[model samples]
Target chain A: MISTTNESDPNPNESTLVEASPRRAWYRVDDFLAMGLAALIIVTATVSALLVRPPNIPQLVQDHQTSKVRLQQLDPSAESFSADRKKIIKQQAEIESSIATMPLKGWLVRPGEWKDDPRAAFVKSDKSIATPLLATFGVLLTLFAAVSFVQGQSAWRFALGFCGVFGLALFSYVLAGQEVVKHYNLEYALWAVLLGLLISNTIGTPKWLSQATRTEFYIKTGLVLLGAEVLFNKLLALGLPGVFVAWVVTPIVLVSTYLFGQYVLRIPSKSLNMVISADMSVCGVSAAVATAAACRAKKEELSLAIGLSLIFTVAMMVVQPFIVRASGMGEVIGGAWMGGTIDSTGAVAAAGELVGSVAKDVAATVKMIQNILIGVIAFAVAIYWVSFVEPRDDGSKPSVMEIWHRFPKFTLGFLLVSLILSVIQSQGIEGKSLVSSIVDGTTKSVREWMFCLAFVSIGLESNFREYRKMLASGKPVILYVCGQTLNLILSFLMAWLMFSKVFPNAASELLAK
Target chain B: MRFINTGVLKFACACAVVVAVWMLVLPVVGDFPSVRQRIEGNRAAGINPTAVFYTDHPAMADIERSIAAKVNAPTGSFWQFSARRPK
Candidate 1:
């Protein structure tokens, strides 16, 4: 009987009850504490309808497991590019066609005239004061927990990472508390300035949270949340012109900027190069996260890339309105240009508002349309990198399958969520109360988990010691400046063509003055 | 061999514990309340994008409508659906 029972026996599969490595700790005491905390959060949220969210566990699991299918067929070469492009175009055309049917008034909010539209004037009478003190409480708690637990090579790592989180969390809280969620903040530039000054003082930032452990969790959870956000119904809101504009602009921005980064600027680091390229090409912070995950970019690289994207994103947000107005572009034109040009959606919306009426709608609509390109772009890049870039190296290159295996497991989950959203949206389940609840829940889980993980990862990977040695400042900073200039120029040009020439609600004059 | 396997299992167990504490569980607990508040804040903002500034003031309605028109435009998402093409 012992001889008959070989190593090939399937009994172990049944008896062992193998759990995935990352998830296995759910049975532990620390994990139990974490869950106890999570459940308390849910209970608090459930007590308030305003904080309502649906379930996201299923969505998270699905996104990770779903990518094996996409991976199996994803060998995108120059030859395959033709068919792929056609399929993508056809698919896009179909989505746009359906979007054209929405009664134009549903998502609409008439901005300029007070007497005409019936919504709040961007702020309500019950205006509340800033909640910085509470946010400070949250930040200090995080810092104490982190600094006391995780030690680095020196004191500065402990200081900077903790301070960085405290500062960023406070800023982020304030932004979200306001009218629009400003995804990128101007304060990051100030952080860079401060860090540069103190980095030499070398207060290293390794605290309790390990960077690799956090990145692994943050990326996956982020993917699931990203999936929920990329619902099909949302895409259908961007009409024909919106579709045409996004199609024309997004890829052009990505490819051209990547080339500029490589040839003109001659950036050396592959990790930095890829991330900057993705950030330029897509929806800034989100794109950086996805691309960083796909490429297995180091935690520091992801953090730096995001920090750069945030800085530039704010620059565009602040400067774009003045430029559009100064350039003598009309409201619609200015809006389109600003919207198409800026990297972050929140910043784009803010810039558009600064211009006046027509520009606000056009800019926001255009940005929203372009934002839909995120999933398609991420998938296309992942496939292309694994299949074409890897294979081109011949014997020295990693196998495509190996590349696939090495690919982030979480993107699969992200795509699956997209597919499920697409299917449900296709079946007319969108806009319903239940679906809305689900999306709310899914997105909530994503933001809560992902942001914390990203912060923790940022803390872990970055320290005063390594950051001081690694930062070679001259060329990369210059490239960032140059790329930013190109973004402004091209975005304004597109705005001119679309708003002034095509749709021109033509507030061009009152605004231009 | 048995001792080695047990050691390996123990190490795996420890990593799993720490990872879960760091990623899934801790994050959900710490920030979920703030996140919930943000979501409601977003919806309260969403229900009337213009409402962030003025209360029931008459000027707000026009501003809200304008914001709605801009945000809710029939923009294409990813794969466009046929037959509903925007005029």
Candidate 2:
């Protein structure tokens, strides 16, 4: 049976049956174990990235520089200038290709895209993904079973349960890999949650399978791993104009939306309100997950927020570009607007591309800069919850010690990993390439699996009754609509001001590159 | 017969619906000319419209590199020179 030995929950049945309150102590044994494993993975990725040196990157950079000089010396109208430019482009591609990726690139594969045939996801061009899938299953089962053993649960039972959970997650990936689903950016998280919900709400989650549905553990670890990808150097992608458009406008929208939900809309669940607010205002699913954890939101609330975001993301992805073109909004401004407003990065890119290439670059860059807010927002929300929200709700002022105890310790791991990686990336081009390789090769795939598993666990844990309760007031939908409207107006204003009025040359300058 | 409970039948139906939508409905939607054009255009530009993060989009690497080079370039460099308009 699923159980926990944590002192906070003495009742074994309670541990298995009920979700723990967000008020539990910050440093549980399971949390520490998750953080420990995450740190180990980060360290492994880093060491591997540094050790696997690309050959003669410096020489390639020199060659590109020489070609650049030659192109510059030629007259602008000269035919040779165009030829030299093409050479420079080819040289740049070589430099990008030379960057060393993680050693486990092929071993950590997920399902590939498939059209018409489901089997194509697993096998393409005689290359079967069975080995990698089996390898992943084995590794995850062993690691999680070890965690169960450390927690004083039956590791054998946990292993048995893990196979079921892993299978569901694998199926979720295949469903998400459908070419049409992938085209619309219907990510695996949505599928994982839906599949889990279908099983749970229909036949109900079996007690045996419940043993391996450690949602919090998986999510915390994934968030920590996510920190490695949030390099601070990305904040400078569009320089000051990008920063003003993303960093400045985002907090205003987030805070304004939250306040509106609280005062005007009078949303009953502040945590739900915050999660929805963050999800709509910041970068979609990632933001919702972080905020939900930080504020200790109910699982149902997180699911609801994600559901709303995904629906809107699809609609916005299709409609926003049409509006941009119709309005005669310049590509840079339109791209920035979409990047700041759209919750998902992929949808933002797709929407921006519908406008123009210049728009796509600006949109993606704005979103990347905005993505860094997850760490800051999570940390702030955690502190706010512990300091004000908890005390007000409980009618007991938490002492400074109590506040510290209530704080989610996992946020610290997330910030620390981001800080360490950002410092590494800030070193030079080699450092940047190394960080990219680590993220692309190892951490990203692992983090995605963790999130998928967490979503599945959430679905298995959730009930229709809880969702009914969440939606009874109709406030979440209203809150999302109101918040998204605010986001659109504010983001468009900021984008226009930054990319047009404030830095009129920035758009044209970006386009030239 | 008793084993095929309401819940089990409902679950089976949900699975069938999911399969049908993925296999049938979505392909038709994707085949629309406007949708096809946008999808093709994005592919040509190396943009993954469904990318969840910046790193997931392969084009981002080139964009990031170009931005970094521009931001870190020396005074009067080729990057700056390229951005200038002809008189």
* Candidate 1 docking DockQ: 0.03
lDDT (tens digit, per residue) of candidate 1 on A105-132: 1211111211111122222333322233
Give the candidate number with the greatest DockQ: 2
Question: DockQ values for all predictions?
Answer: 0.03, 0.39
Of the candidates shown, which would achieve the greatest TM-score relative to the real structure?
2
In the predicted model 2, the residue pairs found to clash are none
Q: Local distance difference test, per candidate?
A: 0.46, 0.79
TM-score result, candidate 1? 0.56
What TM-score does chain B alone reach in each candidate, compared with the true chain B?
0.35, 0.69
| Reference contacts reproduced by model 2 | 0.44
Q: Model 2: per-residue lDDT, tens digit, A1-513?
A: 243323322232321211333443334365577788888777777788667766677886676567556544655456574465546656765665576557876677788777677889998558998998788778677777787776666787778778888889999989988767877878888999999999998887887777778888888888888889887867877877788888998999899999999999998889989999999999999999989988888778888898999999999998999999999988888998999999998889888888887788788889999999888999999899888987545697879987877778788889998999899888755676678778888888888888888889888888888888878888999988988998899889988876666656566656554
